[model samples]
Target: MTNYLQLSNITKTYGHFTALDDVSLSVDKGEFVTFLGPSGSGKTTTLMIIAGFEKASGGKVEVGGRSISELAPHERNIGIVFQNYALFPHKTAVENVYFPLQMRGVSRVQGLRQAEDMLSLVGLKGFGHRHPKELSGGQQQRVALARALVFEPSLLLLDEPLGALDKNLREQMQIEIKRIQRSLGVTTIFVTHDQSEAMSMSDRIVVFEKGRIEQVAAPLDIYHRPQTSFVAAFIGESNLIPAIITSGAGKTAENPTLGAFQYAGDDALADGQKVTLLIRPEHIKLSRSPVEGRKNARMIVETIVNYGDNALVIGRAGDIPMRVRVLGADVVIIKEGEECCISWAPDAVFVITK
Candidate 1:
C-alpha cells in the first residue's frame, strides 16, 4: 500500500531530554493505525508532532507524497479530537459541528444542514439541538466526531477520545468510530494507552517505548509473536521466563529455576544465549494431572481471580510465577492453595530474543 502519511526519522527533544528518537512509520491511505504504549512512552508526543502541536527537533512529516513539515496546525487540515471532547459547552450539537465548516467559509444554511447530516450519521439524529450539558457523554462524543469530520479534513487524529467515557460507552464508541472511519475511508491515527481498544479497532498497531518504535504489526501478530519482551509483557498477561538457549536449531531453551522448555520458532539465537520465553496465560492448561503429550510443570496455586466467564489461576513453578487462564467451568476443578499441573504446547512458547 502507498503511504498516505509518513514520518521520516522523526525526533523530539526538550533541553537534554529526548522525547522521540528517530521514529519513522508509513501509514496507508484510509487505514486505521493506532499508536499504543504506556504513559510517557512517546506515543502521544509522536501524535502531537504529526498534528503540528509539537514541532519535531528532527525529520519530516509527509502526507500524500508531499512534505507537510512546515505546515501550521490549522494549515495541515487535520481534525483532532481530544480526551475531554473539547466541545464548546455553550453551543448545541449542530452548532458545534457547524463551527468547523464555518471556519472553512461554509454558509450558515449549508453548514447547519451538513452538520445535521454528520450528527445523524454518528447516531445522534434528533439530539443535534441539545447543548453539551444536556447531552450524554456518548452524545457529546458523537458531536465531537461530527465536528471533526464536517470539513472533510485530510487526516483524523484521535488522542484518547474515549478516555472520558464509561466502559460500556467506550466500547460502543469503538464500534461506532470504526464504522464511521470505514464508511468515510479517511486515514486515521489514534493514540491511546488502552491495548484492548487498539486490538479491537486498529488495522495495525504501532508500539512505542522510550521514544522509539518497538513493533508495528497487526494485533494478533503483536500478541502472539512479540518482537521484544516489553511487547510481550505490555500487550497481555504473559509468563516471561528468563532462559538460556540450549539449542537454536531444536528450538529449545532452559530457565535456571523452571527447567528446560521447547518452543516452536527458530530465531537468530546462538547456543547458550540468554533470552526470555513468553507463554500467554490463555495458552496454558491447568489440571490435577499433566495432560498427555504436553510440556508439564508443577505449580503451587497462589491466587485465583475469577471474572465470571473466565478465571486466572496464579501460581508458581518453582521460583517462577505462572498464570493460567481457564474457562469458568474448568476453574471448578481447581481452587486456591492447591497444587496443580500446568501444561502447554511447544507452539505456545514464544521466544523474545531481545
Candidate 2:
C-alpha cells in the first residue's frame, strides 16, 4: 500500500544555517502523528515544508505516490489550522467554512449547506450565522477547524491550534480534535511542544531535537523505552543517573553516588560500559524508613511541590538529584530539609547507552 504522506530526506537551509538536516519519515492514512520538540527544534519547519509553505532545499514530498515537491501551498490540498484562527472578520462562521469550497467554485447555497454540516460536526450547529468577532475564542477555533475539513483535503496539519485557549479549553479541544479526526479519517501531522498534549493525542510521536529526528514511537513506548538521553529527559520528569555497566550479561549497572541498580532488560553492552539510568519520578516511593524488597537510597528532601491530589518531592540522593511523586495526602508525612528513604523495583530502571 502507498504511504498517505512521505517525506524523503527533507533538508532546509538558510544561507549558512541548517533548519532541517536529512529528516525523513512517513505517515499512514488516517494516522494521527505528532511532531514534538522544543522551540527551534524543527517540528514546525517540517510541518511547513509538508504544507508546501516552506520548500525543502532537497528531497521529495509525496502523497499517495505522487510527488508534490514543486506544488504551491494551495495546490497541495492540505488543510492547516494555525494558532491564530485565520478567519475573515466579514465572513460568518458558515461563510468562513464555506470559503474553501467557494475557492473551488462551490455555489453559495450548496457550500453553505456543506459548511453548516461541518460546523455541526464540530459542535457549532446553531452558531454558524455569527461572524468571527461575535464568536467565542473556542467557537472561532471550531469555525477554523470546520473550514479546514470542509474541502476534504488529503492531509490535515495542525500547528499548535490549541495554543491560544486556556488550560481547560485547550484540553477539551484536544479530545474534540481527536474525535473529529477519527470521524473523518484524515491523515494528520500535529506540531506542538507540549509533551502532555502529544502524549494524550498522538498514535505515534516523532521527537525532534536540533533539527533532527530523535525517535519515533508510540507514546508509552517513547516514555518507557526512549532511544536517547534527550528523549528520556524531554518526554517527562525523570531521574537520570550516570552509571557504568558492571556486568552487561547480568543486566546490572553501578552509579557512583546512587550505588548499584539492577535493571530488567536484555541489552548487549560491554562490561564497564558507561550508560545512563532512567527512573521516573512516579516510580520512586518515598518513606520514613528503607522500603523492603527494592533498591533503596536516602535522600535529603530539598523541596515539596503539592498539587492537590499528588505531590512532587525533589531532593538529593547522595550527590545526584532525585524526584519522587507521592500522593498529596502522604506529603504531610515528610518535610523539606529532612531525610527520606526512596526505593524502586528493578523493572522501574531503564538504561540509555546513548
Candidate 3:
C-alpha cells in the first residue's frame, strides 16, 4: 500500500525536556491506525503534529505527497475529535454538524441538508433538532463523529473520543466508530491508552513509550510477538520472567526462581543470552494438582478478582508473581491463601530479548 500520511523524524521538546524523539511512521490510505500508550508517550503529540496543531522541533509532515508541516491547523484538511465531544450547547445536532461546512462558505440551505444526511449516516437520523444537552452520551458521540466526517476530511484524528462514557456505552461506541470508519474509508489516527480499544479498532497499532515508538504491527502480532519487554508488559497482563538461554538450539532458558523453560521462537539466540519470557495470564491453567505433560509451578494464591465471565488469580510462585485467567466457574476450585498448581505449554512462552 502507498503511504498516504508520512511523518519523518518528528521531534518535539519543551525547554530541556524532550517529548518526541525522532519518531517516524507511514500510514496507508483508508487504514485505521491507533497510537496507543500511556500518558506523555508522544502519541497525542504526533497526532497534533500531523494535524498542524503543534510544530515539530525537526521533521517533515506530508500528506498525499505534499508537505503540510507549514500549514495552519485549519488549512490541513484534517478533522479532530477530542476526549470531550466539544459540541456547541446552543446549536442543534445538525447545526453542529454543519458548522464546518458553514465555515467553508457553504450556504445554510445546502449545508443543513447535507448535515442531516450525514447525521442519518451516523445513526442520528431525526435527532438533528435536539441540542447537545438533550442527547445521550452515545448520541453526542455520534454527532461528533458526523461532524468530523461531514467535511470529508483528508484525515481524521480522534484523541480518546470515548474516554468519558461508562463501560457499556464505551463498548457500544467502539463498534459504532469502527463501523463508521469502515464505511467512510477515511484515513484515521486514533489515540488511546486503553488496550482493548486499540486491539479491537485498529488496522495497525503504533506502541509508544517514553516518547519513542516501541513497535508497529497488527494487534495480535504486537501481543504475541512483541519485540520488547515494554510492549509485552504494556499491551496486556503478562508474567515476565527473567531468564538466560541454557540451550539456544533447543529453545530452552533458565530462570533462577522459575527454573528451566522451553520457549517458542526461532530467533538466532546465543547461549547465555539474557531474555524476558512473556506468558499471558489466559494461557495458564490452574488446578488442584500438577497437570501432566505441561510445565507446572506451585503458587500461593494471594488474590482472586472475579469478573463474571472470567477470574484473575494473582499469586506467587516462589518470589515470582504470576497471574492466571480461568473461567468464572472454574475459579471456584481454588481459594485465596491456598497452594495451587499452574501449568502452561512450551509454546505459550514468548521470548523477548530486548
Candidate 4:
C-alpha cells in the first residue's frame, strides 16, 4: 500500500547549523509513528517541516501521495497539538473545540454539537462549560486533543504534547492518546525525546541524531538489533564491549570476551576486525553455581546493587563493565560485593560497528 505520508530526501538548516540532513521516511495509513531522539536531534524539526511550520531547505513533503510542500499549513488539513495545552482562557471547553469547526465555515449550532461529541469521545463528557483554569493538567490536555480532532484533519501531529504534565499525568495521557488514536484510526506522528514514551506508543520509532536519521525499526528490533552503536546506546541501557570478530558463519560470530555470538545478517567484517557488542542488562545471566554451558564466555561479578524488585549485578569482562539484571526468585538474598559468575547466550549479543 502507498504510504499515507512521505518525506522524501528532506533537509532543513538554520544559519550555520543543519537541523535535518536528507531525512526520508514514510507513514502508512492508521500507523502511529514516533520521531524519537535527544535534544537538537532534528525530531521536532522534522515534525515542524511536515506540519508546514518550517520549510525544508531541500526535498519534498507528501501527504496521501500528493506533494504538500507548496500548500499552506491550514490548507494541508493537518491537526497539531503543541507541548503546552493551547486552550483559550476566555473560552469554555466547548468553545475552544468549536473554534476549529467554525473556522471551516460550520454553523454555530452544528459546530457546538460536533464539539460536544468530540469532548465526550475524549472522556470529557459534560466538561464543555468548564474553562481551562478550572480543569486539571490531564483534563486540559484532553480538551486540547478534542480541539485538534474536532476539525477531522487527515493527519495529526503531536509535538511533545505530554511534556508539560507531571510524570503520572504524562503516563496516563500517553495511554489515553494511544487509545483515542487507535479508536479513530488516525495516522498520527508524535515527537518526543523520551524513549519510554516512544517505545510504549509507537508502531515504529525513528531515532534521529544531529540532523540525521540514526535508525528506524520496531521498538524491540531497535533495542536488540541496532544497526549502529549510537542507536544501541540511545534507545535503552546497554553494555557496549569492544571485541574482535574471531570466527563466524552467516550472522553468527565468535568474540573473545563473549564467545560465539550472533550479529546482523549483513555484517561481513573480517576476522580480527574491531567491533562493538551490544548486550542488554536483562540478557546477562548470573548464577551462584557454576554455569555449565558457557565455556568461552569470560565474566566475573564486580559489584551488586539491590533495587527491591531486581538486583543489578555489575560484571567485568576484560576492561568493560557488563551489567546483569536479576529478577524474580533468582534475586533472593544476593548481597553486594559478592562473587558470582555471569554469562549470556551467543545470540543475545548483537555486534555493531563503532
Candidate 5:
C-alpha cells in the first residue's frame, strides 16, 4: 500500500531538550494511524510537525511523495482538530465551520452550504445556528471536526480531540470520529495519551516513548505480542516476573520456581541468563487442587478485588506477586490469605529483556 503521509528521520529540538528524536513513520492512504504515549513522549510534537506547526530540525515531511518540509502551515493543506475546539465564541456553528473556506476565497453561500452538509454528516444537523457556548462539549467537538473536514484537505490531524469530554462522551466521540474517517476515506493521524482510545479508534497504533518510536503495529499485535518491555507495560495490564532460562526444550523456558513453559522461539539463550516473563492477568489460572501430570507453579492468594464483571486475584509465588483475572460470576472464589496455584500456558508468557 502506498503511504499518503511520511515523516522521514524527523527530529525537533528546543535547545538542549529534544521533543522528537529522528522519528520516521508512514500513514497509508485512507488509513487511521494513532500516535500513543504518555505526556512528554513526543506524540503531540510529531503530529504538530506533520501539521507544519513545528518545523523539523532534521529530515523531511512528505505527502503523496512530494516534499512538504518547507511548506507553510496553511499551504500544507492539512486539517487539524485540537482538544480545545479553537472555535470563535461569537460565531455560529455554520460560520465557524466555514471559516477555512472563507479564508480560501470561497463564496459565502457556497461555504455555508458546504458547512451545513459537514455538520449534518457529523450528526449536528440543524445545529449550525448554535453558538459555541450554546452547545455541549461533544457538540463543540463535532463542530470542530466539521470545520476541519470542510476544507477537504489531503490529511486530517487530531490532537487529543476527545480529551475535553467526559468518559462516556469521549467513547461515543471515538466511534463517531472513526466512522467519519472511514466514510470520508481521508488519511488521518490521531494523537492521544489514552491507550484504550487509540486501540479502539486506529487501524494501527504507534507507541512512543522519550521522543522515540517504541513499536508500531496493529492493535491486537501490539497488545498480545509486544516487541519491547515498555510496549508490554504501557499498552495494558501485565504481571512481570524476573526469572532465568534453565532449559530450552519444545522452545520453552524452565523457570527454577515457575516450572517449564514453552518459549516463543528457539533463540540461542544461554543457560542461567536473566530474563523477564510477561503474563497478562487474564492468561493466569487459579485453582485449589493441583492437576496431575501438569507442570505449574503454586502461589498463596494475597487479595481479591471484585469489579462487577470480573475479579482480580492477587497471589504470591515465592516473593513475586502475580495477578489473575477471572469471571466475577464464577462459583469458586479464592479468599485472601488462602493458598492457591496459578498456572499459565507457555505460549501465554512473553519473554522480554530488562
Candidate 6:
C-alpha cells in the first residue's frame, strides 16, 4: 500500500482559463484507480498531465518516490492506451507489440519473443500473426495492451480503451483488462466517462467535476455514502430531496412537501440546517397501499422504464420527483398515470450536507 504515485497540488491553465485547479492525488503501487467525470471535468486533463503529454501549471508528478515532472512522455517510462486502439494497420499483432522493445535497443528476436509472451498474457497468443485489420476490435485492443505492457513501464494509463467496441465486447474486455492488470501488477490509472465501467473495474474511483476532484472512494462508498449531492446524483439513480433538519439528535429532517423524515447517518447535523436526503430507487418498495411501520409517499406514476429483469418507476410525490425500482414482474402491478404507494425504512435515507 505504499504511495507509488503522487500528484501534489497539480494545476493546469490555458491563459486565464484554468482547466485544473490544485488537483492532487496519491496512488498505491498495483492499485487500479479510475478517473471518472463528465467531459470538461478535468479527468482527461489530469491523465494527460500525468502521462507528461501536458505540463502542469504548478506542483509535481512523482512516480516510485521520484519526480517525473521534468521527463518527456517517452522518457517518463509510462504506458498509455487511448480510446482508439492506435495499432499500426500494416504491422502484425506481435510486431506491433515488439515495436516498443525494438525502440529500446532489444534485438528483434528477443523483442518478438517477449512480445509473444505478453500477447499470451492478454489472451492473444495464437492470433499474434494477424494484422490489425484481420483482428476484431477486442483482439486489437489486447494487442495494444500487450504493446503497452511489453516495456514494463512504471505506470499504465488507459484512456477509455473500451470506448469504440460494441457493448458485449466492451464488457468482455473489462474483465480481460482487469485480469491482465492484476497479472502484471502495474499501478494503473483509467480515465472514463462511463460510470458502470469505472464501478466494475476500479479499486477506487476518483470523481471529478468542473475542473476539480469531487470525491475519491470505493465504488460502494461513492454510491451509497456520497459526501456531496453531485456525487450522489452522478454515480447512480437517486431521489434527492431538499430538507431542513428539525432535530439533529432525533435523527430527523423535514421537507415542506414530503413532511418529516428520519435519516440514517452519523454526521453531526444541527437543527434548522439545510441538507439533502438521498434515497436510492432500489431501496423503495412500490405497493398498492401504505406498508405499516415504514415511511410512505403517494406517487403519481408518470413513466415506466423496464429493463428485462427490473424496471424504473418515475413520478412525482407531492412536488418532488421520485423514482422507484421494482422487479419486472412486480412492475405489472402499477401503470403510468396511476397512483401508488412507495415506502422505505429509515435506513434507506442517506443525508448529504454538502
lDDT per residue (tens digit) for residues 162-252 in model 3: 9999999999899989999999989999999999999999999999999999999999999999999999989989999999999999999
Q: Model 2, range 1-354, lDDT digits (tens) per residue?
A: 247899999999999999999999998999999999999999999999999989899989999889999999999999999999899999899989999999999999999999999999999999988998899899999999999999999999999999999999999999999999999999999999999999999999999999899999999999999989999999999999999999888888998888887998777889989999999999999899988899999999999999999999999988999999999999998999999899999999999988
Which regions of candidate 5 fall more than 4 Å away from where they truly are? 265-273, 292-295
* 2 against 4, candidate with superior TM-score: 2
lDDT of each: 0.93, 0.94, 0.95, 0.85, 0.88, 0.95
lDDT of 2: 0.94
Model 6 pairs whose backbones collide? none
lDDT of model 3, residue 182: 95
Superposing every Cα of model 4 onto the true structure, what RMSD results?
2.3
**Structural similarity to truth (TM-score) of each candidate:** 0.98, 0.99, 0.98, 0.92, 0.95, 0.99
Q: What's model 6's lDDT at 301?
A: 99
Backbone clash numbers for all candidates listed: 0, 0, 0, 0, 2, 0
- Model 4 scores a C-alpha lDDT of 0.85
lDDT of 6: 0.95
Candidate 1 per-residue lDDT over residues 1-354, each given as its tens digit: 677999999999999999999999999999999999989999999999999999999999999998998999999999999989989988999999999899989999999999999998999999888999998898888899999999998999999999999999999999999999999999999999999999999999999999999999999999999999999999989999999999988888998776887898856678989888999999999989989999899999999999999999999999999999999889988878889999999999988888
Candidate 5, lDDT over the whole model:
0.88
Structural RMSD, model 6 = 0.7
